[model samples]
Target: MPVRPLSPELAEKARNELNETDENKMVDSLQHLKDWLAKQPYLKARTDDQWLAAFLRGCKFSLERTKQKIDLFYTLKKTAPELTPLKYKDPKFSEILDLGVSIVLPKTSNPAEPRILLMRPGLYDPNKYSLGDVMSVGAVIQNIMLMDDDNFVVAGGISIIDLQGCTMAHFAQMNPMLMKKMTVAFQEAAPVRMKGVHYLNTPPGFETIFNFIKGFLNEKNKKRLYVHNTDFESLYKYLPKEVLPTEYGGNAGTAREFTENTKKKILEYSAWLDEEHLYGTEESKRPGKPKTAEELFGVEGSFRQLQKVIMIRELSPDLAHIAKTELNEDPKQTPEDIKHLREWIMKQTHLKARTDHQWLVAMLRGCKFSLERVKEKLDLYYTLRTTSPEVTLRLKPTQPTFINFLRLGTCIILPKATTGLHPRVILIRAGRYDPEKNSVADIMCILYYMVQILVMEDDSATVIGTKIVVDYEGTTLNHLVQANVTLLRKIVAVSQDSLPLRLKGSHHLNVPSGIETIFKLVSAFISEKAKQRLKIHKSADELFEHIPKDVMPPEYGGNGATVAENIEYWITKIREYKSWMEVEERLGTDESRRLGSLPSDEAGDKGSFRQLNID
Candidate 1:
C-alpha cells in the first residue's frame, strides 16, 4: 500500500522545516544513506525506501547525522532488548496492544497536520503491566508508522498523554533507570520527529518526571509542549474537535474505533515485525569503538541498573527534598560529592569500581555523603573478598546449591518497595531451609548477595535504610547447631560496618526456644549501635505495631502478594543481577597492592556453633 498523502502545502513545510533538498538531491541522499548502511560492518538494517525515507525525514535528511542515528536505532534494539524483546505476541505484550493505551487518530482533511498519538498511561494496571511494557508497545506502533503512515513521516507527530486515570501506583512501577535512556531513545534514537507533547489531567507526583523530560526537549518541543491539567478547552486551541476522537469531543470515531484500526495496521505487519529482530548492530563488528552502558547511562550494574539515578527516581520529589534537608546539603551539590569520590576511587590502585553518577549517588546517600565513611565503606566492600572469600568471591548464581537454596523460598524481598522514608522490606525465613543441607555460611552467602543487589539497585534502601524482618517461627535446635559463629560474625561485620545502608531496623519475630541465650549470642557479633535498633517481638501483634501488615506478605494477612509469589520475584531479581555478580567476582581488593593494612571489624567471639545478631 502507498503511504498516506501529505498536502502540497504541508509537503513544502516538511521540506523547509526538515532541511529537505530538491527532488534530485532527495533521491541521491536516499541512495547515499542506503549505500552507507550497506558499507557499515556493524549494522544490518532495513534499507527499503519507506524505512530509509522515514529516517531521512526524522533526521532532516542529513546523511552523516542519519548514519549516526541509524547506528543508535539498531544498536538500541540489540543492546536494550528488555525494552523491545522478541515477544511479538506474548499474552502480556498482546494485552498492551489490545488495551489501546497508545493510539494514532486518523488524519483529518488537512493532510499537512501532524499525526496525533494519544498516549493514555493510566489505561494499564500497574500490577499487571509495567511502564516498559507500555513503552515497548508504543515503540512497535511507531515502527509501524514508518512503513505505512506517510503523513507521520512527512508532516511529523504529536503526543497527547492523557493522564486522567493515572495514579501514584502506576508511577511507582516505572523504572528510574529509564529516565536518561528513554529520553535518548525518543529524542535521539527513534526515527520520528516529536513536534508536540501535551499532558492532560496532570497529577501531583508527575511534576518532577515532567521536569526531567522537559530538560531533554529541544527548543521546538519545548515551545510546543502542552500540559493541560483536566482542561480540555485549552487543548482545543491547538488540536481542534474535528480531529479528536469522540471521547475527546471530536467529530472522529470513538477511541475504540481508532484503537481497533491502529491495532489492525500493526497486526498486518506481524511478519515484518518478526524480521525486525534480525536488524541490529553487532558492536564487535563496529568500526572504531563499541558503546557500553558506561558510555550510555553512566553506570552499569549486573542487569544494567542505573543505581545513581535510581535514588532520585525511587523517592518522590517531596521526600527527596526532605532527605536532602536532613543531610544539611543542597540537592544540587550532590554531583560535586560524587565527583570527588570518583576521583578518590580512581586513585586507589587496589580497586576497580564503577564511577557512574547513579552508582556514586547511592554510595554517597548511604554514607550521607561523608567522604570519610564513603571511603571506608567502599574499601571494606571490595576488601570483602580478601577478608572473607568464602562468602564474597564464590557466589555463583548458576550453582545448584544457590538455586536450590533460592528455591527453598527462604529469602524474600517484599514488593512493597521502600518509597520516600518507607523502608524496602526484606523478609527472611530463618528456618525455611534445612540446616543439615546448608551451613549458616552458605545461607548467609545467599543473603549477602540478596542484600548486595538490594543496596546496589535500591537507592531508597541505601538512603533511608532497609527494614529487615527475620521470621524464626519454624526454627529448631538443629538449625542453631549448624549455624557457624565465625562466619555469621563476618556477615554481621560486613553488613553493619562495610555496607553503606543505614541498616535501618531489624525485627525478630517468634524468637526460638531460648530467647536470652539467643539474644546474648547475637549481641556478641553486632555493635552496640545496632542493638538499640533491634526489635524482638514475642507475637505477630507486637510485630504489627512497628511493621504494618500492609507492607507484609499475604500469608501474614497483609494486602500484598503471597510468600510464594515474593520468593519467585526475589529469585528472579537476584538472577537479574547475575551479570553484576559475575563482574563482582573479577573485581575486589588486592591486599598486596595496598599501602598499609586496612583495618578490619572483628568484635565477635570465636566459639562453638551459635546464633549471631544480623543487623
Candidate 2:
C-alpha cells in the first residue's frame, strides 16, 4: 500500500513555484489555522495534522484560503448526505473498484509530471451499481488524495475520461442531483487543483452529457475541458505514454495492477475515512438558516427542472375536432365534460384516484371524450391496479432488473411519429427476452408504464391506438416454456378491456420457427377482429411493407435515429415522470362495494384462475 514518493528535484521545483521558501512559516500558517478552527464552537473537531498540511499546500500556504476551503469541505460533507458514512467496505464499493472503472496512477512528486487519474465509464455495469455509488467511491478517493501531501495537493491531477463504450444505460444511471453535489464539493470544497479534463474516444451525442457536467463547472475549469474526439494522439501530447498505464499504451503496469494497489491503499486508510465521516458541517450551528438541497444545486431556467417543464403537449385543432366528431360532443364542451368525469370518478365507491385534470383529459382523449367509455375504462383500470399487485407494486423502473431489461434494447419506441398514423410505433425485440430472468408480469408492467406516459402526452394518439412490432429473431423454446400463462392472460385482459388504448396493429417481424406457439398464446386473449390486424413477416422487408421504414430505427433501415439514441431520449422522459408515477402508486380500486365481491381478506382465498378474456 506504500505509494511512490516525490523525487527531491521535483519537490524543490514545486516548492519554489508555491513561494514556500520558508518551511517554518508554512508550518506556522497551518498551526494558526488549526488553532483558529479549534476555537470555533460551530466547527467540529480539527482534522489530523496531515490533512491540515495538505490543505495548506493546496492553497499555496495561504492561511485565509486554507481556512475557507476547510470550512466549505466539512460543510459540503454535512449537507450532501451521500458523502458521509463512507462505506469503502460495502460490497457495491468493492464491485465498482474491482471493475477498475476509475483508477489513480502511482504517485509522482514531479511538478512536471501530471498526477493522472483514469476513468473508464464503460467498465460500469448499470445493472450492478448506480452513478451515486461511483461518486461515493470518488469522494473516498478524493479524501485519500487530500491526505497525500506530496502527490495530489503539490502537483495537482488531471483526469482522462474514456467514454468509448458508454451507452444510454450508463448515462441513465447518473443522478443529476448527486452529480451537482459532487461537482460543487470538488471545485469549491476540495483542495485539489484540477489541471485539465481530457475526454478520450468521445462517443456520439456526448454533448448532452458534456453540457450537463459543464453546467456545474466554473469558468476557469470550463477552459480546461478538452474533448479528444477519438484522438488518442492528442491526449498523448498532454499525458505521455511513460506516465500512463499499459492499458492506455503507457509504460506503467497494467490498469488492473494499479487498480488493485490503489484499492489496497484505500483499505489501509479505513480509520482515517471513518474519522472523516464525523467531520461534516453542523448546520444547527450556523448563524443564519441553512440552505436546502434545491437552494444549493437546483439550476434556474434549466430544462432539467421537471416540475417547470410542461410534459403534456396541447392537442392540435384537427385532433380536437376529430375527438369531437368521433365522440359526438361539442368541441368547446370537452374541458367541462372532462372536469365532470374527474369529479364523478373521484366520487365512485370502487375507484380511488386523485383524478387530476391532466389524467382526466388523457382518459377523455383515449375514449374520444365519450363519457360512458371513459367511466367504464376508469372503473376497470382501477380494478386492475388493485388486484394486480405483482405487476403494479413490484415493477419499479429504478429496480435493477427493469434497468437491465431496458438496457437490452429489446423494447424501443421509434422517435418519429408516422404520418397519418395516430399511434406511436413500439418495437419489441422478442429475441432479447429472457424468460428465466423475467416474467410476463414484468413485461406487462413496463408496457403499461410506457403506454400510460404516451397516452398522457397525446390524447389523439391514444384514441387512434398504438402500433406494435415484435422482432422474434432470437425467440427460443425456453422463453416460451418460462412464460407465465396466468400473467400473460392478465396482461392481455388489461390491454384489451381495461387500458385506454386502441388495438391499431401488431406486426411480427423475423418470425422464428417456433413463432406459432408464441402467436397462439398471444392471440388467445384477443378477439377475431383484433387477430385480423396481426401481420407476420418472415423478413424485415415484409415487415417494412406493413409498417414503413421511415418511422423505424436506423438499425432496421429506417431514416430515424438509432435505437440507442431513442432509448436515451425515452430514458430522460421517463425520469421526468418519476414524480407523477409516485402519485400513481397510491391509486387503486375499493372492491368492497362491488356486487358479489369477496371481502379483502377472503379475496385471496377465492380461485386465482378467474380470467377475464379481452375480446
Candidate 3:
C-alpha cells in the first residue's frame, strides 16, 4: 500500500500552523477557531444558539483560558525575540541560543524521525524560556514540519534533583495553564524519567535539567525523545564546548559557543538576582558602635516626655489650682517654690493613642515649653524628692492594646525604658469602671485594671528599674492579630475585668472574680516610702502620726515590732505554713515531705477558690 499525498493547500496550511515564525500570527484565526469549536461534541452542545450567540459564549470561555498563554508567548517574543527567531533552523542543541523550542515551528516532530519535546514543568515566571526544552521542542517541530509524514515519538526529561525535591510537582501546582497547554499539545507525549543529570551545586537543579532538555532535543530528530537527568554545564564542561556541524552544530558552529557561554552567564545572573531578592528573612544587624544619647534614652522616651509636657500644660489651669490652692506653691517660676510639686496629666486626646514616633514628635512640638518650665521643674523636683502630696488625684490612663505579630501571638509591648538592664515595665489596660461603687462593673475588666495600676504610677521606677509593658483589649471592629508590637503595649494598663463576656451564665461573672484575685495581690505591695518608714522609730512616728491608729499599719500600735517586721512576719508565716520560720524548720521530715507534695494548681487556686467556684 502506498501513502497518499496531502493536498498542496492543506499541506501549506499545516506548514503555516506548524512552522510559522511569528507567534501572534500563529493564533488560530476566527474561522479556524469556529472550525475547531465545531469539533468538540461536548462543548458543541452549547452551540445550539444562533451563530453570534454561540460564538460569543465560546469566545468568552476560550478567552479566559488562553489569555495567560497568549500574554506569556508575546512577552517572551518581546523579551527574547532573538531566541525565538532560530528555534526551527536545523533545531538542535549545538549551542545556547539554539537551546529552546521556537514557537514558530509545529510543536511535534514527524512520524519518520524520533523527536522529543523536553519540558521541565514549573510555575511560570509569567514568560520564561528554557533554552534546552524550547530548543528541543523547536527542533522536533522543525523536523516534523519538514517531515515526509505525521506520526512521531516525543518525550520529556527532568533533573533527578528536581524530582527528588518535588520541584516539578510544585511547578505544576503553581502553573496549571502551562501544564494544560503542553498536555493538550501532545496527547501521546510519553513521560521519560532519566536519572542522568548531576546538577551538584553548580547552578540550581532547574538550570541543569534545562541543559539536559536541550541535549535530548538536538539528538537525531528521531521520533523518540530521550531525556537525561544531568547538569548541562557539567556536561558542557565534559563534552566539547563546540559540537561540529556533522556533530549537530549545524551551520552556525562558531555562534554556538557564544550562545552556550551566554546561557551560562544568564544562569549566573539569574542566581545573583535570586540572592538579591529577599522577603521574609531578617536583615543583618550591624556591629555595635557608640550609642547616641537618643538611643540610650530611647527616641520614644523624648517624645513620651514631650507628650507628657503637652498634656500637663493643657491642664495647667487645673494643675496650677492644685499647686497653688492645695499645695501652696506659686504657679509662676521660682525654682525653690516649684520644688516637690506633683500633678497628674490625664490623657484624653486621640493623639496620645497613636504610637508612631513621627506623630508623637509632631505633637510634642506644639507644647509650650516656656510655660511648662515651671511645671517641668516641679515635675523633676517631685521625681527626686521624698515629700508626699496632700491630696491624691485620679489620672485616666489609656487602655492597653494587643496585637498579633508574626512570631508571637497577642504579646503586650514592653516599654523601651523598661529594656536593657534591670528594667521596670508598667502595663496598662482599660475597662468599664463603676464610679459610684469605685469597683469594676465587669469582672474581666481586671486585666485592664491590673495593667492600669502599673501604668498609673507616677515615676514608678523610683527605687528600681523594671520593664514596663502595656496591652490594650477592646472591641475593635478589626480582628486584630497579635503581631503589632507597638500597639500592644499601649493598653497594658487596662483592667482584665473590662474584657467582654460574650458568653452567658457563670462565665460572665468569672471574669470579674479573676480581676479581684489579681488586685488583692497588687494592693499588697509596700511602697518605698512605706518601707523607709518601717525603719527608725522616729521615722515611723513621723509617718504614722498624721494618720489614725486604724489607718496606720500594724506596727504603729506598739506591736513590739516595726511595720516592715510585721509584714515580714506575716509573709514568713504564710510562706512557711507556720507561725514562725524556726517552727516550720523544726517540723519532722515526714511533715516537710507532706507539705512539698501539695499540687501546685490546688495551692494557687485556693486564693480565689471561693470566688471562682461561686461565680
Candidate 4:
C-alpha cells in the first residue's frame, strides 16, 4: 500500500510548525538540495523528492540543519557498517524480524497522533544475538517510518521499551562506543523526532544505566523519559490502547501481526534500503580532517601496525637506460612525482589505503608517470583485492597452505633481467604441481604473489615491464581440463587489469599437442595487444633466442639462481612483508562510495569474454 497522505489537521500542523506554508518555496529548496548533492564528489545519494523531503521536514525546513543531518544520515552507514548492513539475507535480522522485537504499531486514523516505535528487547536471547543485531533490525523499522509514515515524519514518533526478559549480557552489549553509534544512527542519522520514551517492566539496576545514558540524549528526551514498570493504567494515560499491540491490552493486532506487516513493508522498500547503504559522506572532502571511525563513533583507534617496507630504489645503469627510453621514466622527477600521487591517494575517500613509497613509485613507473593511468591502475588494483577476496586477497604469508605451495617451485620470478632492455623474467612451470592435488587457480595465486613482489621492489620490472614465460613440460588431460574458459578468463583479467606488471613479452614453451585445443579456447579471451606479444617456442634454441641465457634459471642452464634458491628468497621476502600485507589486505574500494561509473573496464572483458575475435 502507498503511504497515506496526512489529514487536514496534520497538514495544517506541518504548515505552521514545519514552515511548509509556501508550496513553491519547498519545490525550490528541494531542487537546491538536489543541485548541492550533484556537486558533492563522494556521496552517491538518492535524489527522490520523498527521500530528500524527510530530511527537510526533520529540520523544519532549516537548510543548514538539513544539510548536516543529511551528511550524518548517509555517513552513519559508512562509519558504522556493523549496525547499518541490515540486508534481507541476514538470518539474525530475519529471526528478530519474526520475534516482534521491534515493530511500529498500527497508526490510528486520529491524524494528530505521532507514530509509535515499539521495542521489546526481552524478546531475543541476549547470548544468541548481540545488541548490534537488534539495533540493525530496529534501524530498518525506524527508516520505514521515515519513508512511509507522514505522521512519523511530520508529527514525529515516540519509543516504548519493554525490558521484560533482559539479562546482564544485554546491558554489556551496550558499551560506551556502541551506544554512541546507535545514538547517532537513530537520532541524527534517521532524524526521527522523539515525543517521549516509556520504559515498561524495568528490571533491577536499570535506572543507573538509563540515567548514565541520559547524558547522550538531548534535553527534550531527558524530560520525556518515563518509567511505567508494568503499570498499563499509567501508560494508558499517554498511549491509548487503540495504538498499542494486543500484548499491551490494545485493540490493534498482536505484536506478531504488526511484525509480519512491518516485514512486508520492509520488503516493499527493499530497493531504497539497499541504495541507502551505498550513499555516504566523502570524509576526505569534508571541511576538517577526514573523520575516522574513532572520531565518528569514539570507538577504538583505526590505526594498523605496519612494518616499514624496504624499497630497492637503486637502479642499474642498464635498467636506468631502459627505464628512460622504453618506460619514459625520468629519474630526476620521479621522487617528487611519487609524493604527489601519494598525496592524491591520501585524499581519496574510497581508497582507505596507506601504500609505501615503493608501491606508489611502482604504479607511476608502470603507467610511465601518466597520473591518470596510474590512478586507474591503483584503483583497479585495490578494487580487485577488496571485491574479490577468495581469488586475490591472499595475505597470510606464514601459513602452511601458501608456504607449502611456494616450495613447489611452480611459479618463479628470476632475479636477473633479460640482456640489453633489462625486463624482468617470470617463469611459470605448468607441470611442476600435480593437477589432481593443485588446480590451475592455486598456481595462479602463487604467480599473483610473485608478480606483486616483482613490481614493488624491482626497478626493471616496474619500469621496463616483465616477460612472462610459461613452460608446459608436463602435459596431461587433467591439467588441460582445469584450464577451463572461466578460470582462464579470471587469470587473464587479473593479468590484464589488476596487476601493475606490464607485459613486455608473453612466451610459451614445450606445448604438448592437446594444448593446441586449450590455446584456441584461451586465444578468444586475451586482448589483441596481448595476443600480438604472444610467442610460442617449439625448441630450447627458439626459447633461448627470445630470452637470453643469463635471464634463465640454472635448471635451464642459465646463470640465474636455481628454482629452489629463488623459492627460498621469495619465502623470506614474503615473511618480511606479512605485516604490510595485513594492512594492504584491508585496502579495497567500498564500491558504495565511488562517485561515478566503476573505474573504466575494471575487470577486463567483464562478462563478455567470449565475444572476441580469434585468429
**TM-scores, each model vs. reference:** 0.57, 0.50, 0.17, 0.48
Candidates in descending TM-score order: 1, 2, 4, 3
Candidate 3 backbone clash number:
86
Residue 128, model 2: lDDT of: 70
For model 4, residues 143-202, the per-residue Cα lDDT tens digits are 667777888889888889999877556776776666667777776777678889999987
In order, candidate lDDTs are 0.72, 0.69, 0.26, 0.74
Report clashes for each candidate as comma-separated counts.
5, 0, 86, 0
**1-615 per-residue lDDT for model 1 (tens digits):** 322344687668766788765666667987898778888888999877778878888888878888888888888876666676526577877788778899999955486777899988888988888777888888888898888887788777888999866765776665555666776788888878877888987754355456556655677777888878778999999889988998887888888998899778878998888887678888898888887655666655532433333233445575577568654445778756876888898999888776645556667777777888788778777777666767664446645567778777777777643332567777888888777776555656776677766655555565567778888878888877764556656767666766666766889987877655766766887777779889988777787776767778777767678888877876766665554566666777777888765644545564211122222
Better of 1 and 2 by TM-score: 1
Model 3 stretches astray by more than 4 angstroms: 1-174, 180-184, 187-615
Q: Give the TM-score of candidate 2.
A: 0.50
Which window of ten consecutive residues has the lowest lDDT sum in model 1? 606-615
The count of backbone overlaps in candidate 1 is: 5
- Candidate 2, residues 397-452, lDDT tens digits: the string is 65556666666777776754556645668888866767777755666677777676
**What's model 4's TM-score?**
0.48
